[model samples]
Target: MTQRTPLHPVHLELGARMVDFGGWDMPLAYGSQIEEHHAVRRDAGMFDVSHMCVVDLHGAAVRDLLSRLLANDVGRLKVPGKALYSCMLREDGGVIDDLIAYFIEEGWFRLVVNAGTAVKDLEWIGRHAAQAGVKVAPRRDLAMIAVQGPNARARVVSQMPAVYQERVLALAPFFGVAGGELFVARTGYTGEDGFEVMLPAVQAPTFWLALKAAGVAPCGLGARDTLRLEAGMNLYGNDMDEGVGPLESGLGWTVVLDGERDFIGREALVEQKRRGGLRRLVGLVLEDRGVLRAHQRVLAGEAGEGEITSGGWSPTMERSIALARVPAGTGDRVQVDLRGRLVSARVVKPPFVRHGQVLVNV
Candidate 1:
């Protein structure tokens, strides 16, 4: 059976186009996907991300368990509500999943993971937590709503209850705050500034209606994909999987390999680093009239060949863009095999757009 979010009725009432996303019936679009994409870039937009699971870790061994499980060190998250992005790795250095860990309080931590991998992630976490003597509890009673754009913070804060009004408005980026039953985080996948609010599932409809009344447009997964791509963010199962490590996925920054901290995949990562031959992830832009789609072969003349991991038409840049894993020697120019023709593309650093400004040279 397909699972419906607390806001399913609300989505149906709004005439949203529904689709199956990792077994959950999710909204793909409200009307025009491109228009909805633009709404998030230029103004404010909201998404029902309740399908993403929130798992809480408790007990004295919580930090120790995380230290051994994740690629990034959790010891860095000292201050309460500080969020750290990390990749959980297998013993062989393959990425199991990417997640956000929030230090809520001593002996308590919060983790938000991708919806598709929630079940496996929980199983993996539980297996390790058992050894560490920690408790892993999934917070199924909560729903998450992400309001993103330049005006996102202001709109969401204004609609929040007075008790949380002051604290939420004062939150810093990459931080989260908890008041009563609500947890508001100043974090988002979209490059634009925003807040991801987690509240009791029953209150979701009321809050969604409040945000809609405040002029926040309801966006779906269609827009969310394009927005995150333009932001140079990685989508699990597309950009990476259990076969790939962070080193080759443009996510080496999230891996903490220093010091005596021995985390999962640390030894494998060290061995891979010493081996030296690895494909590199790069951003590609097609200036000519064409769309770049995933799995397309990329040719770098005599340099080498690679494949596009994630590709799409960026609504913000108004052009075709992609994240491709090509030869380490691949230069600033490459050709994407589109259909039967090899199309030219310029390689540039990612974050194609941020805060309504195009970062790469178009």
Candidate 2:
């Protein structure tokens, strides 16, 4: 049986087309995915991301423990409510999961992880805690809702309690604040201003209702995928896995090599860097009518081939684009094999659309 989130019924009542995502019953779209995506680009939209796991870690040594475990140093977080995005890697340097860690207080951090990988992430975090002498507490009791778009912040804030309303009003981007049992983070996957709220599961329906009343469209996973891809974000299983390293996964910046810390997979990354960086990941824009999809083959001059990891016809840009892992030297002019037909494409940096504007050149 597929797992159901606390707000699953709400999604159904809203006429959302539900599907199985990572073993959980989730919405694919409310009706038209493109319309939902556009809502987020032009106004505000919300997603019931309660399926995502919110784990809270606490212990005297938690700070030091995270600093040692995460590929991105947690020490970089200075502000109390600041959030840091990082990847937890295996000993061999394979990405276990990419998650956001929110620093609330000393020795306490809130980590939100992907639903499918939550159990695995928890196990890995627990194992790390055992060795590092920290405590890992999974917040299964909490549900997450992501409100994204140009007006996303404003729409979501209207639903917050007065105390939280004022606090969130002044909260800067990438920061989070806890209002009673509600934890609001000014962060989201879409390339738009928004918040990802974590609260008790029982309160999910209430919050969802409030957000709907505030005119935030009920967006689903379809829109979320296209939005994140356009924003240059990586999807864990599709973009990278335990078999692929950061250099090939567009996450080279997350790897901290300058430090003396002995994080997992450091040796291999060092070797790969010294040997010349591993094949790089790039964003591709299809000039042709064909849609670019995952696993599609991309061909450059002289038989050079790449593979698309994530692709879609962006509702904001109104064009097909994708993130592809290509040869270390793949060039701008490329062709993607879509259903046996070659489609002309241009390799470009992502954020195909940001703040209601298209970033890619036609």
Supply every candidate's count of residue pairs whose N, Cα or C atoms clash at under 3 angstroms.
0, 0
TM-score of each: 0.99, 0.98
Candidate 2: segments with Cα more than 4 A from true spot: none
Per residue, candidate 1 scores C-alpha lDDT tens digits across 1-362 of: 89989999999999999999988999999999999899999999999999999999999999988999999999999999999999999999999999999999989999999999999999999999998889999999999999999999999999998988899988999999999889999999989999999999999999999999999999999999999999999999999999999999999999998899999899999999999988888899996789999999999877789999999999887899999999888989999999989899999989899989999999
Model 1 alpha-carbon drift over 4 Å, by segment: none
The global Cα lDDT (0 to 1) of model 1 is 0.94
lDDT on C-alpha atoms for all candidate structures: 0.94, 0.88
Give me candidate 2's TM-score against the actual structure: 0.98
What would the TM-score be for candidate 1 when compared with the true structure? 0.99
lDDT of 2 by residue, 243-360 (tens): 9988889998887788687777778778778888377788998998968999998887763788999988877667889999988777788988999999899989876778888888
lDDT of model 1, residue 162: 90
